[model samples]
Target: MSGTAHKADVRSGGQPGSVAVISSHVARGAVGNRAAVFAIETLGHPVIAVPTVLLPWHPGHGPATRIVHDNRQFAGFMADLAHGPFAGEIDAVLSGYLGDADQAAAIAASVAALRSVRPDLVYACDPVIGDESGLYVSGQVARAIAGTLVPVADLATPNRFELAWLSGRVLEDNEAIIDAARALGPPAVLVTSAFAAQPGMTGNLLVLRETAHLAEHAAFDRAPNGTGDLTAALFLAHLVNGRGHLEALRRATASVHDVLANTRARGADELTLAADAALLSEPVSDIDVRSVGRRSEDITIGG
Candidate 1:
């Protein structure tokens, strides 16, 4: 009764590409599958939606009942997706919050299985392990994701805390963040809640093999839960649709800022994504996405 249920004016029909989203499903908040699925679908990519866990709402909102399926049952379900009738439909995979530690290995296996059919299958792993406060998931789950998912992913989106835990270092500055992201195994890593160059600003840092870009927007206190989820989904969708790395990072960061501003205006605890779904596809860009470090590597992102 409390979650978003409105629709966006999408493309004429579902687009050609299909993405498999594996994450949590909250019946009453815009987090995990709820946020990612909407952003991806609005961008015109049909989604093979899969829920890793069921919950009433985000834990930040308060206590809610959690329902994690049996490992064997969950494994069989993923196996079905990999070899099922529509197995070939998945063009990409976006993985997020894990309910069980074993789910990581299963998801890795499925990603591998899907890749066999489509060699260029784009897999973006959002390591939903922790936040500034600390690890929300068990140590085992965090390790599993760092080992099984991040290593095999084409891209990874991890918050600063999660990256710190994964790298076993204190990422006190942008240089350290970039260094840790390089060692994070994924060729492209998008670190959310990254340290910004300017004061009172938050940034999303995209650390690529040869380059890095940081897109900063005004940071707000008590922002919604789904920003990271939405960022990962949008960034991956743009890349799958053939946009370059910097372009995708800029667009995704700008869109998230747009929605965050709108949500704040409405005084909503959760992101008002339903009311701003169209913004995901055509975001109003007032963001400054700049190349990080070294003037030689700096490229102007002209309008």
Candidate 2:
């Protein structure tokens, strides 16, 4: 941040509007890359997601269309980008779920390249790391994402646990979430699994700039993996379309909730957006933007 100048001003070809996502693509499972692709498509943006890791049950049991590559062979894939027509055809970038540090490095470099051509392009980083219990991603990969990838992103969506880990702060409740998000210095923050424990009251908090708003919703009985991907993509799309933070939160939350409800109704494992395509396109029956009021207490930063 010191001398980087933070300049993003470049133009590119190919539709003039698209989102390049950097994350792993699973061929067999409906997780990781498949979720990202679904969310990006729902937001009406073309996606360019490079495969970062390949597992055994891929190509046969995963999403209908998925990019598969060996984790050790990331360089070959990247080298292909440097010499192909894809070198300069990206409008924005949305990244999530890095399997290894090398993958994170590759993604960071690609993000830099995308910025070179699409300077005003919005970069959204979903720094996928650990959940509430413990770290699921390797420490090296987590460090690279927090240290390199996140700082360069214009918008970031990290869950409660990720926020705590990135900020090195203990966040037991809602207020602490805001404090932690502010510390990260990201302009907008969407804490996906926000839970407020104040007796009988329970809700999630969405913070933008320095303002935090709360919305009460029923938490899904089971943890759905792709909810974050959908939330980030929808939030970014709505924000770019001139929707405010709280409004975006409302839309995203409603959308995810509807997806979960549909999944539960069908007794499926994960929230199947494909089954419920309407939820993706029309997250909410109607978009309602309302004032959730200012924080009763201000977040104090120790300079």
Candidate 3:
């Protein structure tokens, strides 16, 4: 946004790729783009952010004033970014929390446009549709993401509930989650809040081909809302930096785990991402990451 020129091209690896981030923007909390843009930027990538919706704080806190740009305005904004000067530098795109069905189509078009310029542009879609509380968004918005965004995404990060909703299956077990993820059409699918064999933990399951990598961390009650947004952005940034899937998952999960712990320690309602900024770049790996079998039993331990 300043006079700074773009970093060296993504191919040369002189610097990490610039990312185009599309998500909801919250004025006061770390959710959606607020979480994503911070995480990506902290991971040492330039971010071009576009807000699909605006809110004073996370709606989960209570009732709040919000703004969802109509389809026309949002499309125009996305179009400008697609054709903007920095478009050529966007080697990756991370999208989450759509305002409406049309926003999904608009984001898909922009992703296509960016891919036309850079064929290798990675689009990571975090389908922020619902949670255990039931389908939070309108059915139409969820369907649009499942039909439009998920089809075009190179990678998809959906929590267990969203994956279940998208696949029209009851993913009561990790095997069902794996099957649903593979059938959902994304080359890589990371299911957050996945089933955990241990009663007190939760996992982020990364499914690729027949292999599944489960990154398990202690489950905290009443975790903040933006962990999904943060995880998606951090994982995308690590991949754009050329890290492999497992390493990316490990680091992102570790970072998120630390943040959640730190937030809970301070009795804070929001993620302390700003106060814990350095943790994003150098997160301590204290969680359990390992390969899992069809029944989700551990196969190989991560060293």
- Backbone clash total for model 2 is 7
lDDT of 1 by residue, 106-224 (tens): 99999999888877778899999989898999999999998899999988999999899999999999889999998988888999999887888899998877778888888988999
RMSD in angstroms between candidate 2 and the native structure over all alpha carbons: 6.3
The TM-score leader among the candidates is 1
What digit string (tens of lDDT, one per residue) describes model 2 on residues 1-303?
Answer: 111112222345424355666666654445666777777666666667765655533322444443445555775566555346866655567788775777767776766765676566677888888787788778998999999888877777898889899999998877788877767876666777776444443354666654676654566656556777777877766655455556666777677777877888888766677887777656654433322324533322110
lDDT of prediction 3: 0.87
Which of the predicted structures, 1 or 3, would earn the higher TM-score when compared with the native? Answer: 1
Per-residue accuracy of model 3 over 1-303 as CA lDDT, tens digit each: 011211225436566568989999999989999999999999888898989889999989899888999899889989889988878888889999987889998999999999889887888999999999998789999999999999998899999999999999999888899999989998889999998889999999998766788988889999988999999998888887777777788888999999999999999999999999998988876766787756454454453
Question: Which residue pairs of candidate 2 clash?
Answer: 8-119, 9-119, 10-117, 10-119, 27-62, 28-61, 28-62
Q: Is candidate 1 or candidate 2 better by lDDT?
A: 1
Full candidate order by TM-score, most accurate first: 1, 3, 2
lDDT per prediction?
A: 0.87, 0.66, 0.87
Those runs of model 3 whose alpha carbons end farther than 4 Å from true positions after fitting are 1-15, 295-303
